[model samples]
Target chain A: MVMSCRDRVLAAINQETLDRPPVAVFTTCDTIGMMKASGASWPEAHSDPQKMATLGCAQADYFGLESVRAGFCLTEEAEALGCPIDMGTSHSSPMLKGHRNKYDPMKKIYDEPNDLPDIDVFLNTKRVKTTIEAMKIMKKTHGEKYCVVGGNTGPFTLCGHLLNTENLVYSVWTDPKEAQKWVAAIAPYCKAFGQALLDAGADIVQMSEPSASTDILAPSDFPIQSGQFVKHALGDLTGHTILHICGDSAPIIPFMFDTGVTGISVEEKVPPEKAVKIANKRGALVGNVGCAMPLYKGTPQEVAKAARASRDAGFNVISAGCGVPIGTPDDNIRALVKAITG
Target chain B: MNDKKLLKELADSVVACDPNRARIASEEALKEGIDPVEAINKGLVIGMGVIGNDYAEHKIYLPQVLVAAHSMYEGLNVLLPAIPKGDLSDAKTAITAVVQGDVHDIGKNIVKTMLTAGGYIVNDLGKDVTPSSIANTAKETSVNVVCLSTLMTPTMDSMQEAVKLINDNGYHKNCIITIGGPPTSEKFAKEIGADHRDDDAQSCVKYVNSKMKKEVK
Candidate 1:
């Protein structure tokens, strides 16, 4: 009845033999209610390596999440890139409002990347450094046990977060070539970022691109600007590469596979069968869990039902389709683990 | 310029979301002395209404809706200014949010904007809205309708809970409560006694029109 949660998840990751598909209890901050119930705290994880690893391990121990992602958002990189975050109620990641405000459409757009942002995010920032150190610590704590996943905003997504998609979409249409230049810059950064994660002992490197999803851009738009750079980033990435995009990504999913993403994680809006078809034709299918279901209001039993559906649907890893919502219930976390294990 | 073909063309412009074309279309209708209301009702409003439906059905996305609504508004801008604003008794008022225990704000924001451009005055109760707060807003704002949203299935019960409170408070008497989001459906709304259910922002306008016309029992 009891086996190592880490092994179950890693087996799925390796695409090896498995009793049941591994379910990742997505590590978005637990809901206020659940946090209060578990008596858990944050800022400790954000600031301390040991506490952060403890936080990461706690989710796995409690819920049987096969994989543990950094849980930090892309705003971390944007913040280093000179964007100030609103520090909204919960971990408000910074946004690049300044550059976006007077963005000129006709001018040559460049990702305008520099090593400075990377240095700050990876070495200087207390929170950033602490996050990396935590991964190292979690590696020591559970590395031999489970797969530690690392996430970063895809370059295009980071750019969207910077310039705001309101204008970003316009730029995509008007200055397509300039946009490519901007996207190209992020590829090296993404590659570097992924490398940093792998070096930190992450078994999986998750890179989500909000800009490439069909919900955002058409398939016709993929080949030129966004998809090419992603292909570049994917080629250089070590370990398993996961491409996470929001919404129904059925149309552009094939292109995602063409880039050789080791796996694809999608939201509930995207049918699991579609992803399964794609995965069957290509690589591993990671998820399509309703972020709100287990992470918000659903009980352990409901989580089990959802997991059973995922198992039936052929999802290799049970993961929320999107980032876990803030304040998700702990029992629900227990339920998510139960779903994967039971 | 007030050609019917031109007006229809203008309406199509709204659907394509080209405000300049929409403006040209609206001006032609007015110059031809078309009944401003009829021009709006038949030309721009009806077309944009379709986009909202398309959005609900996932036939169209947020960007398309934004463009279509923007086009409709440009047409409205041409007409609203030209004609002495008459009482368009068809105005709808909606209170929307992501519901409590949820923090997603984009879907609610897009839907609200579309509804507002559709001539519905919307009060965004903001993300993570509690049921009691939603009920209170309905009571206090004299809102014509309550629109509850949640992108998560777990928070869906919150929508049901909000709808129940509205009924319990007798706020459902004349007011139509509409709910939609990633997990919501028309059928789900009916199961919970919600007066209206739309998964997309566009269809709600038509539903709103139907509700406004219904006689109070």
Candidate 2:
């Protein structure tokens, strides 16, 4: 029997044998091409459930990616938690304008994380609600044919968003216990949001923890600073989970896997063979394609080359190393799909 | 403590990420009538240089670098005010910013700290800075270097635009342009007309220093 795209992705997540692994982007991949193809653009698609579902499915509908995912950016949780945001234009993703609380390490001052919104209240906030609703829409609209993937910010990244990230990172050295308190407090909200996404029909919850990557945190500190909290927030969820951390993640791949995620999505900075070697098939692997280079900047041939490289290196799901650049050309994305599916 | 011991304490304090120790050492240096500029250059900068090199070599990471930066600043808070205002007039100047449409500034902040430690008078434009603002600041300050950074690929265009605006305003003649961030590459830097691209702050500052020396010749 021919496997459906949805089944193919689920199989990949299960580490099941397949003729070929699925081509999907678990990270945010809503681009201008996708926006135009689905007739749903950002700032609007980011909030409207139907538009979000439409745009989220555009990867499968127009580009042949095996899975459909949303919401397009990482700011939703931060915004719901009270950070001021700039709802960017069609060509740009949302940006955090400012942290919600004072976290000044230089002055040794920080606002306590005691007053976060209740879990149910946070899950029901404007954009967070919209994302959960969009997941429902995606399942209803494309569930039979494509896997519905839900993307959320990781706990450490969310806490950093609530307080200033630089200040939080500074506290990691000056007062680690205090830093852990804020991340610990923020983890439940992350868990609640992930569970809400799964409850709403997402097949997989992909959590991005860029701030906890080796670039920011010492590899030795990863398990303590972010990994254990991520385990409770993501690994404990009732569905598949993929943890993505930006930068050269070779040093922390084991720690990421220690979160007990079904898989880990990594950026292109880690060479594909090296990533595969390090992962040692601990679980499903979702990425190693350079998002900026061959996908966003290079030609279709280069895109195909990179995609094929990831495939040949035995990635379970060939996908962008990070969030797809919003302006990535249509042909390049098509090339990625074609290189794999062919 | 004597001046030599005090200066070593200041340097060691920054390396150890001890802001209070740095502050105390800075106070002691001042009490001993040590030239504040000598204290900053030989003490704080030396410590920061060690941290920067460690970061570049991947021996240390951002948290340590950030704490080290804070320690350096704590010492600077005490020593900087004591230096005669005109004493730093000949220091090379630089401007740093995270280009428009992006707000991730940790990398930019590291570059700023390294430049400041390298003894450059740096004017930080902060995050979400417009290309025009960067160009205008470069022109107004007559800086020796312009450093642009962004962590997102979509904003790479903004880095390119900022480079063009700086050149269009003829500040390119006065300043060397450098770009950093995870998404930026040396190829992108060359395509965008930037003078240099580096993955770490220490090398970036070294490149700027090298270019400035050549210009002086």
Candidate 3:
């Protein structure tokens, strides 16, 4: 019997043999062509659950992407947390406006350990509600056939946005106990948010924690700061959980597995030989494809070649290294999908 | 304290990321009539060198590096005023900013701080900076390099636009454009007409050092 898209993705995440390897993208599926075709433009699409759902569904319904991912921008969680946001253009993700914590304190955003924004406020925000609605719509329309992937700001990245990135880093050094407390406070929210995504009908929840990557943070700090928070935040997911971090994560791959996620999504910078070997011992390996050069700028043939190479090397599921860029050619995305399905 | 011991203390304070210690060391050096150039070179810069290497090697991470930079800044605010105005003539002047449509600045901040530690006179334009402003700043400051950073792929075009504005404004003749960030690459840099693209702040500093022959005061 032919496996459904949902089965294919679940099988891949569970490391089961597939009719063929499943192709998935853990990043945003929004593209200019996708937006134009689905009649879902950003700024509006970012706010309107209907438009956002259309853009996400177009991934599976339109481009043959196995997983339809939503929450196009990373700023949604920050917006809910009280950061002023600029919903970017049709081609861009929304970004946090001026530094929110620059007003009252110099050393930190929250003067006291308990001063962090209430988790209830974040859950009730319009953006979060819209995202939940979008996930529901995707699950309703395509969940039976395709995997509906939902995510929000992971703790480290969200903290980076809340307190200025520099201030957060400084506080982590100057007052580690306080920093840990702040992160601990955010952990429950992270769990609640991920649970909300799953409750909204997502089969897999991706904790996109790029800030915790080895590229940006010290490898030593990963297990302590980001690793601990991620473990606390998404450890109890009823559905499969995928942890996606940007940049060369070879050094921290083992630590990522220790977080107890079902799968790990790494970018092209990590050597496939290493990722495959390490992932075999830990969990399912999702990606090692270049998102920019081959997947976005290179021809379909190049993308297919890249995908085939990743699959041949033991990557259970083929995926883009990072979020698919806005202007990435439709054929490039199709090349990835076709490489697996065909 | 002897000049050597005092300078070592200054360097140690920064490596420890101790602002109060750094400030106190700077004051002691000033009271001892130690030359400001020696204090910055033998003390502040030396400490940053260690921090930079630790960061590059992953022996230390963002928090340590950021706090160390802050400590250096605390020391420099005391020592810099004492340096003779003309002593920095050979130092290259550079401007750094996160490109328009992108609010990410941690990479840009690291580059700016590292460049300063490398003895460059860096003017940070902060985040969400416009291409016109980048070009205008280059023209106004007569800088040797303009460093742009963007983590968002959508803002990659803004890097190209900034390069175009710099070239159109004729600042390209004097100012070399460099782009850094996750999505930026050598191909993207060349495609955008940028002169160079470095993987990190340290590499950018080395690139600028080789090109400008920055005097290590």
Candidate 4:
């Protein structure tokens, strides 16, 4: 019997024997081909749930990726929390331009933790509302066939977004306690937003904490700066949770498991054999594809070869280690799916 | 205050990430009549060099690097204005900007910091800078080098555009165009007709500094 995408993904997360290894892309995979196919792209896709759903569906619908996730960018939480956004063009994801308090938005948050934007205000923001609506649409359309994944910025990254990333990084050393408090303050909001994503019918919720990667945060500090806060933000979600840290994360893979996530997704920096060995003791593993290198620069044949190597190396769910670059060709994505299916 | 001792203390202050100590060391170097430029290169830049090396090796992370850069800025703020204008008038100028449509500037910012720390007069055009703006700034500043940065592949076309614009502006012959970021490579640099691409800030500093030396000779 053929397993549904939802079942295959959940089985991988639960470490159950599967009919076949699941293939998914945890973060943004909306290529320009996807945009053209849906007639929905960024800037507009960012604001319109219908367009967002249409673009998001193209991944699973057209390319045969087992999972589909909406909200193609990480700016939702920041924009909701009062950061001014530059709604980018068809090729670029929206970006946070500035905060409400030009001088020190983060300082303002730290000074008045109680005065941070209310939960109601966060939910009412344009992007958040539409993001939830997009998830709902995906669930309605592809609920039985594919896994509908949704995500929010993990606590540390969310704090980094609200405050400037530079300030947030410095604060981790200079003011560890306040930095923890700042992230802790937003944990509830992240949890609430994640639960909303589930309510909208997502099977798995991913928390991308690229800021907490070993490239940015010391591996030794991962437990507090990332692991504990990830738990704080996502502990209450009813669905399975996946954690993604953007760079080579081998050293902190064990600590990441301690956060109670069902799976950990990694970039190409972590060797597939190493990821498998680490996950054998921890949890499910996903990804090691080079999103920018071969997928963006090389041919579909290269992507297929990488996909086969990643599969043989024991990635539980085959995927690109980072978000699929916006310029990644459609043929490459199709090749990725074909390699796994073959 | 022996010059070598004062410079050592200045470097130590920055490595320790103590802005107050950096400021104090800079003041003492000035009071002792040390050449501010020498103090900056020998002291502050040395500290940043240590920070840069640590970052490249993954021994230090973003938090430590950010703090170290802040400390260096504190020291530079004291020394930069005191130097006579004509004394460093021959300093090589470089224009740096994030390619158009790419707002990710952390890598570019770090590169700018290291370039400035390496004694280059850097004109930072900030984020989402267009190709025409970068080419225009290069022409107006009469810069010896132009560095383009972008974190996303979709926006890399803008890096090529900036290169073409620089050539169109007649600055290509004199200016060394370089691109840096995670997605960029030496092959991509060559394909776009750029002079160099290095993922690390220190290498970028080394490249420009070496070119500056050759030009002077």
Candidate 5:
């Protein structure tokens, strides 16, 4: 019997045995093709729940992928927390304009995280609420057939959004205790927002903490600076969760698993075989495809080759190494799905 | 302390990520009659170069790199004004910018710091810079290198546009254009008509230096 898309994904997350892992994008995958197919583009769909749901599900509807995700960018929490944002055109994802609070490393001054809005107020903020509502709509419309994934900024990254990331990182070296205080203060909001997504019908909360990636934080510092806080913000969630850290996460794969997440997503910087070996069945493994290369710029043949390699490498879910670029070619995505499902 | 000790102190302060120590060391180097340019090149620059290499090798990460960059800047603030005004006129010039539609500039900032440490007169156009502005800056300044960066794939088009503008305006012949950031690759660089691409700031600067040396030959 053929397993349902929803069942396949849940099974993959559970690390259950399957003939073929489902082809899904746990990260943001809203493409131009998706926009055209759904008639819901960015900068507008990013705000409208119905449009967001339409665009989010366009992946499964148009490309034959098995999971749906929403909130194309990581700035939702940052924007809701008071950072000015430039909601870019259909071609560009949302970009953070500036930090909401003072965090000048050179001047050695910073605003305490204590003044952040209450957790309830934060959850109900405009874009944050929009994402939750979109999750609900996606669940109602397509959740039975496909998993509805809710993407959110991780706590360390959210803290960086409020305070300047460079400044926060500088503190990690000169004054680590101060940096921990701010990240700890900001984590509850991450947890609350994640729980809200789950409550609103998202099957998985994929938290992207790019700021805490091995590229920025030393591996030794991950546990204290980001991993522990992430354990609370993501691990403590009532539903399944996946933690994504950009760059070569080979160094911190174990640390990421220690967060108690149901799965972890990594970028192509880590070799696919190396990632699986390092993961060692810690949990569900979801990626290794080069989003920039074969997916957006290379041919469909290259995309298929990559997809098969990920499957052969023993990844639980075949997905993008990172958020699928908005301009990724439709043929490449279709090739990825067909490579695995066929 | 002796002049040699003071210079070593300046480098040590930066590597140690202590801005105040770097500042004091810079002042001491000046008091000991060490040339400010030598203090920068032999001291602060050496320290930053070590940090940059460590970052490239993953021996250290961004936090240490940022702090070390901050410390170097603190020392530079002390030593720069003391240098004779025209001493830097022959220094190679470079332009760095985060392309339009992307505001994540941590990578760009690191490149800028590395270029500055490498003795380039880096004109940072800051974040969310338009492609036109980048091209115009390269043309107007006659820079020896143009470094473009954006962390988002959506903004890769902006980087491509900036490179095209530089090429269309005939500035590519005069300057080497390099692109960095997670989304960019050597393939993307070649596709966009850029001269080079690198994953880390140290390699970017090293590439520019090697190319400039070949040009001088």
Candidate 6:
């Protein structure tokens, strides 16, 4: 008999072949049914160790997936660092509230990597520490059974929230060096945060860095802009690592391989075959589902077909090409399972 | 101010986004005595048609394209005032909004700016607007076109519902209702019954303009 689902996933993470490909579901704690079942609630569930561990365990049973990751939005690190997010509603993800200049007026963002508006708040903030604890507990509970993926906001994405993007994009044109200074300030947060999870028994660390993605930035600036720092920091971490960027990154797909990530998650807007071919040349790939289509609106059978298509396209794991929407139907996951096991 | 120079200049004005220069050029062409319709069509509208293509190609960014449309608007704004009133052969109205529940207004704003640049009097409803507001406004304002945008997947259903509400209530019978955004698709448009769908803000102006047809005499 197999040792455990956890062992299976860990072996898979190290690129060791297994009975089947490892599956990971990127989810947020806000899911209605999951929260109700696990009795975990936000801010607390986000930072509470037991609640996070329980919730993390529920991921496999809930979605029949191979990996369960902690933390949904990269905004938390930025929010911890003193940004006010317009959390919008119970349903939506938080967004930086004001124009970039309104809060972070100071240029060259190196003000001692405080995870919150003040240095003290970050130190006390329970979520980061809670999440790490949850990872350890998850390992204790399922470490023998499943793969646990821990996540951190990349340096540039964290800084994008901190410094604000309004001036960042324009400044990219006017002054490259100044932008670099702002980006460099947040590197410590990602490194520390990533290290926290690794220390807690996370088998793989995922960097959810949207700002580094080409959707918002020119491909030419990706490497030195932020990728280099992540490559080094995550490289030093004990577990295998993956980098996920949202949106079409056709122009930068080939170059992204140089970042040293064991895997990359690109969105469906990118042709899966192209991404697969690129990944085949560079490394492993996880997704390219038309997230908006099957995951959000398509029927279970249609979603299963989409899963088959993803497999045909040559992905190692079939998942939402982007973050799984909270509104996603339960049947969608079932369809993915049906497609995979079939 | 012959037919050739006037239209060419109007087209040039839409590209340059220089309203002041465009107005002066249109006036000079008029003084030199050119066919107003020819100048508006061959020069201004036609030039914007090309800019729409470039905008889609990413050959030109927002600032350049918006300013170019502004130049056309300036020239048209001047012409509208000078046109022999009541015989307004080139006036058009359009209503644009960044659908309710979505906060991303930058794209909607750009589309409004482009429409204005292309000589269409646009009703900018700002952002987070409900379908009822759009439909009621369409009825009251007698807009020739209605454009709705939503940037979120959660709100995409609302966008689809907005179009359905408009059509069910007969709002679409009066004016063409359309939608666009990152999540929108031709299939979505067909399922929900949007009269038109545009992937580019600049192209939307052209689509609306093309729908106008031989301005009511």
lDDT of 4 by residue, B116-161 (tens): 8888888899988988999998888789888899977777888989
Model 2 per-residue lDDT tens digits across residues B118-217: 9988899999999999999989878888999999999999999999998898879888899999888899899999989999999999998888888732
Interface RMSD (Å), each candidate?
A: 5.2, 0.7, 1.5, 1.5, 0.9, 4.0
Flag the better candidate by TM-score, 4 or 6. Answer: 4
Q: Report per-candidate DockQ.
A: 0.19, 0.88, 0.67, 0.70, 0.87, 0.18
In candidate 1, list every pair of residues with a backbone clash.
Answer: A30-A327, A31-A327, A31-A328, A32-A327, A85-A94, A111-A182, B2-B28, B52-B202, B56-B200
Which segments of candidate 6 are over 4 A away from where they belong?
A27-56, A99-137, A162-167, A211-214, A224-226, A229-238, B1-52, B58-96, B99-101, B123-142, B164-170, B214-217
| Candidate 4, CAPRI quality class derived from DockQ | medium
TM-score of 4: 0.95
lDDT of 1 by residue, A36-66 (tens): 4434445344455665566666656655567
Query: lDDT of each prediction vs. the true structure?
Result: 0.67, 0.92, 0.83, 0.84, 0.92, 0.67
Runs of candidate 4 with Cα error greater than 4 angstroms are A101-110, B215-217
What is candidate 3's DockQ? 0.67
TM-score, candidate 6, is: 0.77
Q: Pick the winner on DockQ between candidates 4 and 6.
A: 4
Best by lDDT: 2
**Candidate 1 regions with alpha-carbon error over 4 angstroms:** A1-8, A26-40, A72-74, A86-123, A170-182, A185-188, A210-212, A219-225, A270-274, B53-61, B95-106, B113-141, B150-174, B183-197, B215-217
- The segments of candidate 2 whose C-alpha lies over 4 angstroms from its true place after superposition are none
- TM-score, candidate 3, is 0.95
Tens digit of per-residue lDDT, candidate 4, span A233-288: 77557878889988779999998888888888888878888888887747788887
Candidate 1 displacement at residue B97 in angstroms? 4.7
- For residue A239, what is the lDDT in candidate 4? 78
Span of 10 residues, lowest total lDDT, candidate 1 chain A: A87-96
Q: Assess the local accuracy of residue B99 in candidate 2 as a C-alpha lDDT between 0 and 100.
A: 98
Q: lDDT by residue for model 6 over A43-92, one digit each (tens)?
A: 45565688767766666767677677676555667666666765554355
| Candidate 5 or 4, higher lDDT | 5
